[model samples]
Target: MTQSPLHILEHTFGYREFRGPQAAIIDALVTGKDALVLMPTGGGKSLCYQIPALARPGVGVVVSPLIALMQDQVDALRALGVRAGFLNSSLSPEAVRDTERALWAGELDLLYVAPERLIQDRTLELLHQCDIALFAIDEAHCVAQWGHDFRADYLRLNVLHQAFPQVPRIALTATADVRTRQEIIERLALEQAEQFIAGFDRPNIQYRITQKNNPRRQLLQFLREEHSANAGIVYCLSRRKVEDTAAWLCEQGFNALPYHAGLSPQLRQHNQSRFLRDEGIVMVATIAFGMGIDKPDVRFVAHLDLPKSIEAYYQETGRAGRDGEPATALLLYGLEDVVKLRQMLGQSEGSEEHKRQEQQRLNAMLGLCEITSCRRQTLLRYFGDNLAEPCGNCDACLHPAETWDATEAVQMALSCVYRTGQRFGANHVIDVLRGSEAEKVLQFNHHKVSTYGIGKNLSAGEWRSVFRQLMARGYLDVDPEGYGSLRLNPSCRALLRGETAVHLRKDAKLAAPEAPRRSPARDIDPVDLPLWNALRACRKRLAETQGVPPYVIFHDATLREMVARRPVTEAQLLEVTGVGDSKLARFGEEFLAVLRAEDYEGAI
Candidate 1:
């Protein structure tokens, strides 16, 4: 007897129901129709195709860019008793031949391949010999030439449609705006596919953005206060910063590692493996590090520098709290981040139109950082989703920002920039306004300017806030010549001439850091702590024996459920979420033994 999709969900994957549009998507693919799915990171997008592959008649071919993570993905599926395999550079020739044999013999329900490999003439020819169920193009946004994380190899994926016109294809991504969506549809030849745009909201993850003030110290304080013993990722803008930050964090007694394109492949793989397998390890990396990470319990994602666009920021931060538990996304940015990012963008070799689009994206990202209203509302609106009311989870909603009339302050700052030849950066211009007799101010003889010392009522930090907001609001522009000079934009003319009133978000004074609100073991009761540790130990042992990540056996969420319910028998253990038949047959006895021992010890 064949199992229905719902039956497979319950008996194999251990879920009772599908999430969002997952059921509809599976129905489409199982009926031999194509689909285009835009779901969030933790939205169970994989299930949309995986279920159809099991319910339908042939092997599902997944085109993935994460060659390094393909083995982990396959390991995870196999843990759930799904016949999954992959062909990537990580495999030996013998292993590749073995996997190919499995595919030809109809032993695999799913086969994962890199786009580069799948587009090869040899791979395409080999696929033509087998029965293909459906093609899933993961990370579908990479097909967009103007999008972040573009890959040349993805452009050739159109061949899948041309070669296998009768086979259904599903393209999926976690991030894409209207333009990129159109690009994916066109590039992949998915014009006839049904579009499923799920809501792009991660309410469990709190959003926090703050101005950079001695950012390293700020990061340390954040770690000590909120995520002291949790796993997280810290993002930097450069490889050197990644290395430096990782070293500094280790000095501060954190188990932090650096990951960048500059690291040797062996070391990078080792570091990534440890981060996935160990508890309370932090990975500090550049943008190149996290395109396809599937870790679910990341407690936080911190940015010491600004991201290039809201889309990039969304994609990176979405890695946290993927298990639907509470997570935090913290960002600390300053005017210097904006300057550095703009300089990099200006130096890019992209066409003029591409450069302009990127500049607009950067400006929008700055607007998100500087907004006094609800950050989540503004963030979702950027992606074409609207929240009916303010999301009380973001920093702005939690601590409402105060604004003040800064008309005079704006006039003083812009006039100072104009009077100082508009060639210096924010610091020098701010010095001229705040009555600083610093050496540079004296060297340039800027004291004679009429705007000099006109804004002495505000402190240096306050002036910096004004200038940062000025740049964020488009009243000031960074020079395009790669210099850090500040120039007055045409938009600032009305403000400088006192024709417009400027209301700026008042900077909050540094307060004593709050105590960690959520514990590493948030849901487990104190009495169950020992049992939780024992269960985790059991899972770790099993993972080590299998040579896979611990989460592949069971997510933290599933473990927490076990701790809460204390299932001691086969029936009770099977009732726990994520306890499918294959997992029960494989490791249920070990977990039950642990639970029974704890109960017996408690009775004593």
Candidate 2:
């Protein structure tokens, strides 16, 4: 007999209730219906499909793009006492055949296969002989050609519907704008799928964006103050930067490692393994590092350079604080970062419309950085999601940015761009405005211009801030063909002519580095610290024996609960949020023993 979704969710997954639209999505899938789900990270998206897979008869064939994480994903399920296995290149031929036989014998509840492997004719033929419950396409946004992370194999996923017309199919993703959503529907032939948008807000993450000034030092201070000894990701725009940041962080006594496409495959895999298996390993990487990572307790994600778009930013930062704990997303960006991104965009071999869309996305990212209001509000508005009130956690809400009437400064900066023949970048324009006698200023005879000495009151840094704000607010445009020169937008005519006033956000002064005021981990009482360490040690030992990451055993939240509630019996242990029947049976007594020994003084 088949179990109900709620029964599976509680007995198998140890959750009493569904979060957000999980129950509805699961019901639709269990009843042989299609679905397209857009849920944020840590929003329990997996349960929407996993529960249905278990509740329904036959094996759930999950088509995922994360080939590297297939083992971990299946391991997590197997830990839940669900019969789960995966078929990918990582498995040996013998192992693959074993998994296939298990599926044939109806011994597996779920089977994960990468898109590249699933598209194989032999794999499809083998699946045709098996009892299939449903098909789930993970990371559905990869189907969008213009998205930040596009996989060609995702384009061929429409075959799932054509081949398995009688089987229910669901597409799931954590990040998608309206355009990307439509693209997924079209590309995956999911027009008939019921859409479930769980909104794009990650309230547990604190958004903190600041202007770049000695970014290495700034990142150092941030790590020292808030995230010292916690696992996090530090993103850089280039491989060289990733290497340098990783090395510098290591020199500063951090357990940092570099990961980029430039690294050898073996080395990259080694570093990634260390990051997942070891505690407090900071992986300094380029954009290539974050997709498919299932680590839930990443306390922070810092960016030494600006991402190209808000979508990319949201997706990357969402990796942090996935366990629903307080986490930080710190981005330190500068005008040069913007220029570099635009230059790369301009050189792309995309259609004019595609480039235009990309530019708009970049502009939106810049707007998020410069907005003086709540960062979460502006970020959510971009995704067509609305927060009724300000999120009181972002840097903007905690310490509001000061705004100043910069109408005169903006007008002067615009005038300087115009007087410099519109062929100069912000540095040249600012130099001209501040009456600099640099050779470039004299070489172009810019000193003779009327605007050269008119803005001597503001410092050069101040003028750069003004120009950056102007660009961010759409008053100024960058000419990529002209080598990133500054040009005034026609909309700026009103401000230049004094018909409109401009108010720009003043950059906050960098504060001195200090230790974190509070702990990034759960707020356990000092008396409970010993038990907390004991539970963590037990979890680590089990994880090592099982050859999985520590988090795969149990999250820190779960351990904290074990410490607080002190569950002594099997029934009491099952009451913990993450403690399901499988976990309780497999490791319940081990944990109960630790809890019973309240005076256990083992150090972590």
Candidate 3:
């Protein structure tokens, strides 16, 4: 008799139960059905297909986007005693031939291949010859043309359904808004596939966004205060910024590295390998760095510049705290960031409709930044997920923002813009409003206007914040044709006429929290610290010896559990969440030795 999926999951993967829709997805695929799964990062999406691959008769072909991702997945699967291999450029010719031979002989349960390779005629013919159980398309959002991670290779994936109509197919993505979701379904021809939309909230991550003021200094402060000893990723918008920030962080005595497409392939791979293998390394990178990374203990993701869209922001920040431990997502934005981003969008090559859509998306991102309510609620609502109440984890909830009636301030700002002829940008308009005697204010003779000096009580930063909120709330618009000149929208007429009241978060008091002196790992007991360190040391040593990522050896969560529970025997160890039979046989003795030593020490 054949073993059940639950048996394979418990014995091979070491989990006693399935998470979210894993069991349902696996059962559907195993029984020959298609699915489109939208799960958050660290949500156990891999198991949705992996279990089906093991239970089904033939090979489960995974369409992966990156070579590193394929290699990591194969390594983890092999560690679980699963028959898995990959066919990608990273593999040597002999190894490719061997993998191909194994697939033909029905010896492999799962075969991971890049989309570019999978779409090839030669590869298609070979796969057609094999009895395929299913085609699992990882990162399916890449097929969306408007998506941040779009790939032309993904456009060819429709061939999978065309050629193997009888085989089940499962497409999975961690981030996709409603539009992108529809695009994935239409593009991949998955109209008949069951759609499983999981909750988008990653509750473990605490979200915070501060207005950018001396971004480098602010980033350093955030690092020194909150995440000095933890692994994190700092994202910059440009390659130059990435390099400079990484170098600067290194000078500050952090293990920092730069990763961008401009770097040589060898250097990129080296930096990525270092980030994956080492603990407490900060990878300062452009958007090119993340996507397929499987590192689990990244404690935070900091954004030094504004992201292009909420989708981009979500996907990038989602890289952190994949182990379900508490993590931080910090973003710093300023008016200049909005101007630069809008300018870039204006100059970018695209159809008029595309540009309009991009602008709308940017506007949505700006709204998220300026929201006075719970950040998590605002974020989830963008993806069509509603939180019943405030998340109480985000900065807005932890330290609620104070809103003030900005009707008068907004009226003054808009009047100033109008009186200044709406031909000048924010700085000039702000100068006129705040009664500045700067040359431009005098050059334009703006100091002579009645609205001039009306905003003298508000500081430049406060005025800037008010203006940003006005633009975000649609009472004001940035005139791209006029070099970012502030223009009053028709809606401002109501406020300017006292017909409407505007409220805004008081920007002056919205300072970031001071760094706490205590460690984030305070949940661990004092008595368990030594044992925790011992477990980590043993795991790190094993990772070094095996030459795989440490998380692949065992997640930090698993180590913490071992320290807390102090399992004494093999049977007790198997009760741990991540302890599968394969890991128990391979690493059980080493961990047990450390635990037993700690136990003996305590007894003595």
Candidate 4:
């Protein structure tokens, strides 16, 4: 019997199978045809190109926009004894020269390059000189106008095919709308590409939201009980919030790190690297943290703040369960998150119409967070796919949701917004519902309003449910400019007049008594012990030396990996997943310095 290339793909890439439409995409690419591969996160997206690359006759040029640098990727490949190299601005003249020499000598299998470098005059000339295989544009959605990480560099991708018209090109993205699919094809010059759209369902990831009450405590409880210190990323809306949340996690004895744009470039890079190592380090960061990151073992992605849109939420959450392991997307939200998200969008630099579209996307995210029916069904429906039941893996499934008939509650909440002229935020509305006689409440004369105290039947918590559910269901809109004041959208007219019946799912129930805390995070042994200050020092040193995302280098995974393996040498050190070439060469010495100081070596 003769061995097929797919058999070799399974052994070399550590995969035994091709998933979803992967076989078709690989077939097309191998036949010298262009392709568009759209698989969800954790789906075998890389195999679509990797398998074809190895099967093809020449070096595969994978143009990627991952947050890591050339050193990180090239090293990972080299560690596996696969001949791979990356060319980018971050590489030194000597490294770049060596890589080019290897490429020309046919010593490289895959050559990873930033899109900018791939389109350079010298680079294109070099490509012309070398025998090129397929060109894979990873993170293909960045070329799409609707994508979160839209980049002008991606727009230049068409030049690759234009310059080498015969080269097979494959564009891969985890998330894309129909419009984005078209944009990617047009932008990447893959006009004749075969398109493979995989299911967007992440059945293994549980989705849940905790009402924001003592949010700090709720977050702590969540991490402690359900999502502990596993390879998780905690999203914050601001740099300050990122810092504070990271600090809070530290206090709770979680191996947590903070990442934001405000950090030095080197610091961000190091933090990113750490997170990717994947032992388990909680990374608290803003929206800048994830874009084309390749780490596959993230256990959970939690949001302390509302994400800007459903696309962002989906992409971020998709970061979890990349290893085909079960994960969760837990959002700890309140009515306030909606307002803040709206405010940020409203004040964004884009045009009015852009803001409008952004609002629609945000509304979609809000709807998903608030939905009670099958979480899987709603998400797929949005992407023009549908599922029939709640994915058993989600919070909605573990704790079956109860419904609250809000017919009269909706009218009261809407009347409050309407009488308040829809100018006030949730705080003011809450005050009116509870009939608070506080100074601000009286100053606005909200106490005298007809709708005031009408919601007294509901507790402050219950009233919040009314409004938040209304906003999620499209009966109301949040004013983005004012940090989320309630506004009457067109859908509200019928609802406010009692012409429509409104219902919302009761919030997810707490874990049952005697049940172990819901998350694998409790398996951590820090016992909430103090490792934060130590972790920060380790994070700082790693970031300063390696010029990539600290999260990428030592993400939650690396930190936990460090704690578990305690690698003591260059030999043992390379075992960490995210420890790349630049990072190993740069910080490898200092990490040894720590191990020697603590007399720590691999034991866990």
Candidate 5:
């Protein structure tokens, strides 16, 4: 008799139950049906396919885009006593031959390959000779040409369905919007597959977006106040910024590293390895990083510039707090970021239609940043999910923004731009409005205009906010050809005529100074601290010996459970989550000794 999926789940993976449609999706795959799974990060999407792969007769072939992470994944599976191996560019020819022999001998349960390798004729022939369980395509969003993470190799993945129509295929991604979802379905030829759309919300993450005022200082404040001893990722818009930020953070005594395309491959790999293996290291990077990073305990993800679209922002921020522990997603944006982003988009070479579509996406992202309502709800709604109520965890919910009518201010700003010939950028128009007697203002003769000095009531920052909101709301437009000069859009006509009343959120004067909120995951009792630290030290030592990430040894959650339960015997240890049979037989006695020693000490 074959072991049931539930039996495998308990004895192999050691989880008590499946989470959020995992069981249904697993059942569908185990029974030889195609599936398109849309699950969030840390949502156990891997389990949906892994368990089915085990239950089925043949090895599961996983197509992954991340070459760097393949070894990590295979190492983790090997630790679980699963016969998993990867074939990629990183392997030697002898190692590849050995893996092929294992596959032919049916000695492997799962195999991971890159899309480029999987599409090779020889590789396809080898797969044809095996009794394949299924094909799992991770990061399916890369198939969409317009997606931020597009990979040309992914476009050829449709051949999987064409070549092996009988074998089940599952396409999984955590960051697909509605259009991208449709594109995935059409491109992958999974039109008939069962679609499992999980909720997009990551309730464990607390979202915060602040106007970028002294952005470096704001980032420092966040790190010191909230994530002093935690692992995090800081995303910048440029490679130079990433290098500079990483260097500055290191000077400030942070375990910081930079990752980008421009870095030498050796340096990039070394930095990524250090970040994965060590604790409390912060990786400052451009969008080039964090596609397939499996680190589960990242405490925060901060953005130093505006992302290109809501999908891009969501995907980047979703990297935080994957362990279901409380985490922070901080974004700092200023008028300059908007102007730079707009300029970039304008200069990008694409069809007019494509450019228009990208601009619309940018506008949507700007709306999300400027929205005064619930950030989470607004974010989910963009992905076609509607929350019944506002999430109480985001900054907007914690500190509701206060709005004030900006009718007269909007009129004055628009009139100033118009009267100044609409060829000047926001800085010049702002200077003219604020009655600046600067040389440029006099050279442009804007001080003599009737609109000059009409807006002295607002500060430079306040006027900048008004202009940003106006652009975000479509009341103003940027003339890319005119060097980012401000122009009045048709929407401004209504505001100019007093036919519409515009209200804007009062930008917070400064980021509030507050300690990081305590999280349940980190709420170990005073007495348990010593034991927790000891357990962590033991895990770290073992991880070093094994050359695998500590989380691969055991997650922090599992460690916390061991501390809380203080299991004395093998049976009790087995009762703890994540302590599978292989781990029990391997390191059970070592952990039991730690617990027993701690218990004895407490008695003393």
Candidate 6:
């Protein structure tokens, strides 16, 4: 059997060899078999369609969702000497016309179009005239109503095959659950297409969700630890928060910028460009900042507010560590996030069915936050995937979560809430528990309550944990209808009767309680910014080259080591922390070249 030179060429211009589903996906497309690729965020997904598009006869049609992605992908492809162009709202009419002319003239290798534009009759008519190789639906999960960035325009993608039935179509998405995958299949009318699910586990990402007590300070700590690398995305719930957080981050002397729907398109583009091209810019944005985005070196993804679902969480966290080096997803939440989220949920304008599905999604996100077991396990389970053991990469696994029989403490707490007339949230109730003689305690006469001064031994943080855990464990519920008052749940009866043990797990801190003091300015990697960047370019090129996902070769840790060590030989590579024998032998040559050919040395 003759190997198609696409496999060989894949290594040449692209970088690495194909691994796992990549070759099969390329083969499926090369053979004109329509396919759906359900790959994780950093899963070498772009190559599945891109390589085959370049390998086979004519221009590959890639239907992308975001304007930023189209620009960046085209730029990257052009850098590697592959002809690429995009037709989206961002392009002028003349640009779109010239791109269409190029498509008809067969001057471009890959053509990316927004789904809305792809659906237009004029575009379809022009596409029909071209010797189209394949139709690649990027971000295919947007077809589902259950998706975080649902695009009604994606529903039109199904008609593509009907118009150009002979052309093979490959639908792809970075994050899609079984439901969303199925929806993409049905909607695209590709039921017979081969389904390729690259591994969902992002082993390099350290997944963590911290309680949102003083999120600003907590965010500062994460930046301190991870900012030695490119500062990562900090996602907030609202446009206001995005602006506020971005401003605050800048004040702290980080090159942070804001991006949200509310921003002028020019500003959003400017912020995105700064993040994409420059190093160490923390783009504080809403979820709008990252879909279909191809930024491989985002060191961390911090959530300043609650994410709505497991899919949304997976997609957002998935953005970090895409380069397969160790990145972090630091999510900060409080009990009030649920209330605030549910309030937002309750206000959404949609069919009742949509609302119900959204509620289920939010509930799943809340469960992930509340789960005491391995967080990665819960996250995988939510996507209808399974993991055998604790990930050992998340907060729960890093520090084994502590659980105490809170049956008595919960009983006292719930009974106290009930006695206090069930009108107060956790803070006020905790005030009563610790016998705070503050004005509210004295005015409401909570100081005289039976629970007052009974738990003075518990620290303020510990008491907050008790309340959060109580709410999570279902002994209490936050009544969104009642200004977030703590209401006694039916489980409280069993706890109050001492028949059931109310297990309360302590909320883990942002950093270890005993960790050393950190310098605010020390967060920036003034030491080796130039070196780390070259290693990052290595990761990105290697990811693009071998059809094998970037993370599989060497994690960000290994790359950082190569940069920090300036490893020039295989032996030196072995000495790097994350570069084991197999990885060193495999990627040693590529990485050495990356280090030797360095402009970033002066950047340091």
User: Local distance difference test, per candidate?
Assistant: 0.90, 0.88, 0.87, 0.74, 0.90, 0.76
Q: Residue-wise lDDT of candidate 5 within 1-604, one digit each (tens)?
A: 4578998889888899999999999999999999999999999999989999999999999999998889899988888889999999988999999999999999999999999999999999999999999999999999999889999999999999999999999999999888899999999999899999999999999989989889988998888877888899999999999999999999988899999999888898899999999999999999999998999999999999999999999899999988899889999998887887888888889889889889989999999999989999999999988899999888888888999999999999999999999999999999999999999999978889999999999999999999988888877878878898988898789889999998998998445533374333368988788788778877887899999999998999999999889899999999999999988887788788888883534422
TM-score of each: 0.97, 0.97, 0.95, 0.82, 0.97, 0.83
For residue 424, give model 4's deviation from the true position in Å: 2.2
lDDT (10s digit) by residue, model 2, range 1-604: 9999988988998888989899899999998999999999999988888888888889999988777778888888889899999988888999989998998899999999989999999899989999899999999999999899999999999999899999999999989999999999999888999999988999989888999888887888888877778999999989998998899999999999999989887898789988999998999999999887989989899998999999999999999989988888999988888777877888889999999999899999999999989999999999899999999888888888898999988889998899999998899888888889999999999999999889999987788788777877778877878889978899999988899988888888654322252353448888877888888889999999999898888888888888778888999999998899999989898888888884676433
- Candidate 6 structure quality by residue, lDDT tens digits, 1-604: 3236354343324333566788888888889898888778878788787777877889998998887667777765654557889999888889878998899999988998998999999999998888988899888888986678889999888888799899999988877777778888888999889888777888888888878888898888777754644658989989998999889888888888999999898888888877776657789999888886676767788898888888888888888867666677888998777666765666778888888888778777877887778999888777667899888888888877777776677777888889889888888888888888889989988888788888787877787777776765556766656777778888678778888876767776776422322322222377766667666667667656754334445555556656567877777666665454445556678777767765665422
Clashing pairs in 1: none
In candidate 5, which residue ranges exceed 4 Å CA deviation?
Answer: 510-521, 598-604
Evaluated against the true structure, the overall lDDT of model 1 is 0.90
Candidate 6 residue pairs in clash (backbone atoms < 3 Å): 14-545, 15-545, 16-545, 16-546, 17-546, 324-551, 325-555, 325-556, 326-556
Better of 2 and 4 by lDDT: 2
User: Candidate 4: what lDDT?
Assistant: 0.74
Model 5 root mean square deviation, Cα atoms: 1.9
Report residue 156 deviation for candidate 3 (angstroms).
1.4
Give lDDT tens digits, candidate 4, residues 1-604: 3235566454354334666788888889888999888889878787788778778888899998763655666654554346888888878899889999999888888999988888889898988988887999998888876568887889888898779999999989888877678888788877788888888988767776666777777777767876554668888889998998898788889999999999998999878777765356888999888766666667778888887777787889898877555676778887777666666776788888788777788878887777666667777887777687656655566666788887887878888888988898877888987788989889988889997777777787777777777777777777766557788889788987777787776665444322334443343575322333354367655555544334544545565666577677976766665565445665667665665454222211
Tell me the lDDT of model 3 at 48: 93
Point out the higher-scoring one by lDDT: 3 or 6.
3
- Residues 1-604, candidate 3, lDDT per residue (tens digit)? 4468999889888889998888888888888999999999989998899888888889999998888667777888888888999999988999999999999999999999999899889899999889898899999999999778999999989998899899999999999998999999999999999999999999989899878778888888888877888889999999999999998999999999999999998899999989998988999999998997889888899998999999999999999889888888999988888877877887888999889888888989998998878999999998999999999888888877788998888889999989999888888888888888999888878878999888999989888888877877777777777898878889888888999888888763335553442343656777777777778788888888888888888887888888778898999999998889999998899889988893534432
Backbone atom clashes (below 3 Å) for every candidate: 0, 1, 0, 41, 0, 9
- Model 3 — TM-score against the truth? 0.95
Q: What does the lDDT read for residue 24 in candidate 2?
A: 93
Residue pairs clashing, model 2: 225-516
Question: CA lDDT of 506 in candidate 6?
Answer: 72
